[model samples]
Target: MGLGAGRPAATRGVLARVSTAVVVAGVLGLAGACAGGGGGGEGGQGRLAVGLLLPGGGASRFGQFDRPLIEQRVEELCPRCPAVAVAATPDPAVQRQQLESMITRGVDVLIIAAIDPKLLRPSVEAAHRAGIPVVAYDRLAQGPVAGYVTFDGAEVGRLQAEALLQAMAARGKGEQIVMMNGATSDPNAGWFKEGSLAVLKGTAVKIGKSYDTVGWRPENAFVNMRGAVAALGGGSIDGVLAANDSLAGAVISALNATEVRPLPPVTGQDADLAAVQRIVRGEQYMTVYKPFKPAADAAVDMAVALGQGRPVGSIATRTVDSATTEDIPSVLLPSVAVTVGNIKDTVVKDGMYTIDQVCPPRLRSACDKAGLTG
Candidate 1:
């Protein structure tokens, strides 16, 4: 089921109206703050402070896109509002401390991409107690979050599985595949696995083995893939459903070590620079391109709204239920399946990456074949 599948229309309409009013009030307050040199009276006016706590730097997207985009958007929307960002490096304990620090320091709002949703519940609850609104970014952090922003995670999994199935069509029925899932702590990982299972289960493909990489670490994935190769026997595996590009890289590295001829097709996500290059070189099959701009923008919008003590119903169209929070306002963006054929149309055209950025000198020939050249 989708995030907001069962909400009544009447409630949605009411939330929309509330959101519109909040937005207007927020705008007026922003103007007042600027005029007064960053200080206002009611409705959370003045210089707003937003805290951005990311999971880690493991995934390239967090640093390459999410942080800068969110910071830039926060500046653009509320120039007086300053966003303070910190990376937790996938440690829930460290994230908890960071949350406590942010709360202690008195940030007006927080945007958290949790390392472990359940583990961070207490911290989230602490933030709530302090009257600081939390906006869950990319991951659905448990607890009382004011809002959430992420891509359709289940669709991401379905896209990867569907692409893998197509790539493995020649192998046909009874083909063995290994599932290299992300960290189990991440809710998105479960959603991805669920969506992929929806496509791969009961089909011609047989799940030879599945491993949830701890902390979504490439090194851990490397170890897991190596073990899978040793146990399943090299060249026996048909395809690999890598949760994202980082894991795909590790899986590919493992396959390379075994010297598997005609390497099996692998699926990935995040469209990381290295992953895109892998696709160009035919080392990886495909990736799910989640345009981060919209998601980041939505998070910033919601952060500003919440910081200003305004409703986010207009910004967050959908409502998602978490382990502790129900009907939480959310903005779930769409994702695109990117193959070598459309790298230019998806990432390049969107200006997420330039031709030169993705196409290196050594990859020129491959880029030409993929039509990624100037």
Candidate 2:
């Protein structure tokens, strides 16, 4: 959620380049697929209509990584597929409206990253009533959805917890750590919370207090951090378990506002550039680095396959049942943990970010220290 959220221009440029490559991949695969289906039109042979909905638009990763990548994959898997994407940022009402629109449009399949997993149930149920399939994207959207596609969210939390504990031990101080989790409305947030708690069960570190961050907003995290600081005394916190990089930023900012030198270790996710820089400066401990390419590509492939009336069973690794349905074809991807020491191996080598962006003049020294720039 954190990678390049503010700069739309740079994010759009990155998407433009990557989308072009995705298109090329799509055309080659799609043409071959249709040829094998006989010299008929895409739909005349096996055309499929698919619908997609995502939770947010503010994150650069969504438009830059998920949208075009999924579109291209659909093209590759289903030459004659028609796909529509309707999504918004943190607006459950808008998402509900979009779901209804998708249903009214009579799409054959639905893929959704639910804005509110619970509130979106009625629409998912309606899709089932109409005989359409649903694939829960990312957060295991609730209702009669067919399948679920996402990385191991619990593992993401575990990584952050492990890294924070490691950082705490390095200080050799038995101080308390504060947990700032994501929104309660999100299933992944709960999964992440459970994972982190599992890791910290027997540690010497005592929990001072925890808060469920709403909207995953930097401001919300900031306010929460301020509260924690006031309640526990500014310097009492040994570490912060910020659910993601955005929260980590807020935590660091709040801590710095108190005139604290060398901020306590904080855990984060999404591997946002700012967080990466923080890691370089030794302000944040770690973040979860999810390769958006694979996650994006897998969703695209599944959506496209659904659109083509082809068997997604050929591609998907497993089948999951949501509250409303079961046995929907899906793909679950893998993720990695990012720290200053391995930025080059994860985001850099994957071409998610260029050295220029990460190693700006101000961050040059930090990059060198982190082995990010030669």
lDDT of 1 at 170: 51
Give the per-residue lDDT of model 1 (tens digit) for 1-374.
33622111111122233322211001112333422221122465456667778866544578778877876775666575434344445556666667777788787778888877776788899999999899999988888888999998889999999999988985563389999998877888888888899998788778888998887899999999889888998678999999999999999998998788778999999999999999999999999999998988888778777887778877877788886778889888899999998999998999988999898899999999888877
Q: How high a TM-score does candidate 2 get? A: 0.83
Ten-residue stretch with the least lDDT total in model 1? 20-29
lDDT of 1 at 230: 88
Candidate 2, run of 10 with poorest lDDT: 1-10
Best by TM-score: 1
TM-score of each: 0.87, 0.83
- Measured over all alpha carbons after superposition, the RMSD of each candidate to the real structure, in angstroms, is 9.1, 8.8
Which stretches of model 1 miss by more than 4 angstroms? Answer: 1-43, 57-59, 80-88, 170-174
Off by over 4 Å in 2: 1-46, 78-86, 309-311, 319-329
lDDT of each: 0.79, 0.71
